[model samples]
Every structure is written in structure tokens, then in C-alpha cells.
Target: MIFVTIGSIFPFDRMIRAMDDWASAEGRGEEVFAQIGDGSFEPRHMRWVRRLDRGAYAEAMASSRLIVAHAGVGSVVTAGELGKPIVVMPRRAALGEHTSDHQVETVSWLRGKPGLVVADGEADLPECIAAAAAAANAGARLATTADTGLIERLRHFIHG
Candidate 1:
């Protein structure tokens, strides 16, 4: 199963639509479930919801074979902790998908990280998904070292 998420703060119809189209065309027999935020593009090829509750979100992530998500820190962190194969497609501000290009910066920093495939745009998504699927089949797991460091930093920042 491929679990797709775009977080909850913003609508990311571009990513959702791309994934839906890719899944329909690829016919790889993988089930896709998406948490699409408040996006307007309705997925035709995969199961999707506008938003998921915390428990449902956790359950989806835990059960997913691969995670296709926007390059949000929260999503990345959750995927990292779950040790899932993740393909990140950053939302572009120029396309009105985000408020800024922070997701682009995030993906740049995270590209080549273990268990991650960064898709620069919709065109790269299918290839990245294929890569993620291959990695998952090969038993690849993301190292949580970076996540641990991030947690520590957050803890200090919050508690200090």
C-alpha cells in the first residue's frame, strides 16, 4: 500500500492529482490511500480522505508499505520513525501550492537520505514511486538518527 499525505495546513491538489493519475496509469497493483488535506482534486484511482484523525493517521502510516508525501517535516519525521520508504514531492510556491519554497529547501537537504526518494515535480513522481517500491521490496529502512537529533533539538528549543 502507498500512503499519501500532504499535511493539514494547506491544500496540495497538484500532488494528489499527480499521484492519482500515476497510480491509475501504472497499474502496479498497489493500493493507495491518501490524506489529501483540503485539496479540491478528488482522487479517482485511490482511496482518499480530506483529513484523518490522529489515530487513523498513525494507523495508516503504520500499515503503509511506502509513503508518498509532501516534503513537510512532520510527515518526514513520522515516516523516518516508522522506518518506511518515503518519496517526497515538495510543494511549489510558484504554483500556489504553498506560502513559500521551504518544502523545496527541505527536500534539497533531505535528498539522498536513506529510504527517501525526492521528486522535484509531478514528472518525477512515478520514477520516485518506483524507486521507493524497489527499496521497500529490498527491505530498505530509513535510519532514525536524524530524527533523534531533531527531537533533541526540539526538546531543547521547547524546554530551554
Candidate 2:
């Protein structure tokens, strides 16, 4: 079971489409599932789940061997905490889901991090998916830039 969730805020239709195509071609007959918010994504081979509760979401993450998602820090942190290898794709601002092109920067930062693979475009997604599909293959790595220290500091500021 290959579980994928694209947070409603991200532009992930392209990535979803590519994954669906690959799943069919590879003939692995894998079950690809996701949540389609904004009613934009037309789920094909991948089953479009209408919604998932928090427990369901966490369970899904736990069950998944490969977690592909947008370059959101929350998702990255959760996946990392669970020790799941994640393939992150940034949502481009030009595509109109974001206020600016910050996700590209986020993806870049994550790409440099260990235990993370950033899939920035459609062309890059299939390979990343394949690499992850291979058991215990972490794929190409650049550097590990994820840090929880900043998050802790931010929490202190918020609570202060």
C-alpha cells in the first residue's frame, strides 16, 4: 500500500497525475490513495479519499512505507518523527496555490537534508517514486538541513 496525502493548500495535481500514470505502467498494481480538496484533483488509478480523521491520517502515515507529500514543515516533521522516508514536492507560486515561490526555497532546504528527497517537478517525481519503491533505497541525498530547535524557539515566543 502506497499512501500519499497532498495537503489541500498545495498544488499537487501534477504530482498526483504522474504517480497515477507510473503506478499503471509499473504494473505493481499498488493502491494509491489521497485526499482531494478544492475539488481540483481528478484521481485516476489513485483512489481519492474524501477525508481522513487525525487518527486515520496518523495510521495511514504509519502504514505507509513511502510518504510523498508537499514541502511543508509539519508534514516533514511528522514523517521524520515516524522515521518514514519522505519525497517532498514544492508547490509553485506561478501555479497559483501559494502567495509566493517560498515552497521552492523550502524544497531546496529540505533537499539538502538527510533522510529527505525533494521532487520539485513532474519529470522528477517518477524517479523519486521508483527509488523509494525499492526497499531501503533512500535515493540521492544532498544534505540534511532540518532542525527542530527553531520550532521550539517559535513555540516559546508564541507562549510568551
Candidate 3:
């Protein structure tokens, strides 16, 4: 299954709509499940709920083959910790999805990371999702912890 989540703090109607459309168009509606948050746009092609409890969310993530989510730190980090493949679409400030374009910055830094795919826009989601799924099938997986070099750099920077 493809698990689509937009986090809990904001309503991401645009992401939800794009996923729903993709599911319908690809005829993979039955394989997609979304935790849509408070989005007003109801998904017609795939199964969805407005919110998921922590346990349910964990279970969904554990069971899914590919995760689709907004570019939030928690989702991305959790996907990494679980060694799951994820496709991220940052919420845009100009589109009223966020207060700033920080998510875009996050995506830029994470673009080439293992097991992560960055979708530049809704138009790129289908291809991004497909690529992530294919990578997962080929045994590509994210790290479960921060790299030792990164941790050492942070320690040095903080101590100095």
C-alpha cells in the first residue's frame, strides 16, 4: 500500500487532491490510503481519514511499501528511522500552505538522500512515487540513525 500523510498541524488540501487524482488516474486507488488531516477536499479515489492516532499511524507506516507525505521533519525522520522509502512534497508558502518556505529548503537539502524522493510540485508526484516504490523494491533503504560524521561535526561545532 501507498501511505499518504500530510501531518497533523495543517490542512494540505492540495497534496490530498493531487494524491487522489494520481490514484484515480493510475487505477491504483485501492492501494492508496491517506491520513488527510483537516483538509476540506475529500478523497474519492482512495481510502482516507481526517486523522490517525499514533498507534494507527505507526502501524500504517510499518505496513506500507511506499510513503507519500508533505515535507515535514517528523515524517521524514520517522520514515528514515524505519528504513522506509518516502516521497515528499513541500507545502508552499505562496499557496497558503505554510507561513514560510522552510519546507522547500528542507527538500533542497534532502534531495539526494537515500530512500527519499522530492516532488517539485503536484505534477511530479506520480513519477516520484513510482521511483520511490521501485527503489524500495530493489532494496534501497534509508539510514536508521544520523551519520557518524554529521554527529561528530555537530559535536565539534557545539563544543567550540
**Largest lDDT belongs to which candidate?**
3
Candidate 2 Cα errors over 4 Å, as ranges: 133-160
Estimated TM-score per prediction?
Answer: 0.88, 0.78, 0.93
Per-residue C-alpha lDDT of model 1 across residues 33-60, encoded as one tens digit per residue: 9999877789999999999999999999
Candidate number with the higher lDDT (1 or 3): 3
lDDT of 2 at 132: 52
Please report, in order, the local distance difference test score of every candidate based on alpha carbons.
Answer: 0.90, 0.71, 0.91
RMSD of each: 3.8, 4.9, 1.6
| Model 2 score (lDDT) | 0.71
Candidate numbers, best TM-score first, in rank order: 3, 1, 2
Write candidate 2's Cα lDDT for 101-151 as tens digits: 877988876664656777878778777776655533644332244357987
Q: Which sequence of candidate numbers ranks them by lDDT, best first?
A: 3, 1, 2
In candidate 3 the C-alpha lDDT for residue 109 amounts to 93
**Where in model 3 is the C-alpha error above 4 Å?**
27-30, 155-160
Model 2 residue 130 lDDT? 69
Residue-by-residue lDDT tens digits, candidate 3, 1-160: 8899999998999999999999899845458999998878999999999999999999999888889999999999889888899999999999999999999999999998879999999999989988998888888887777789999999999998
Residues forming the 10-long window of minimal summed lDDT in candidate 1: 139-148
- Total clashes for model 3: 0
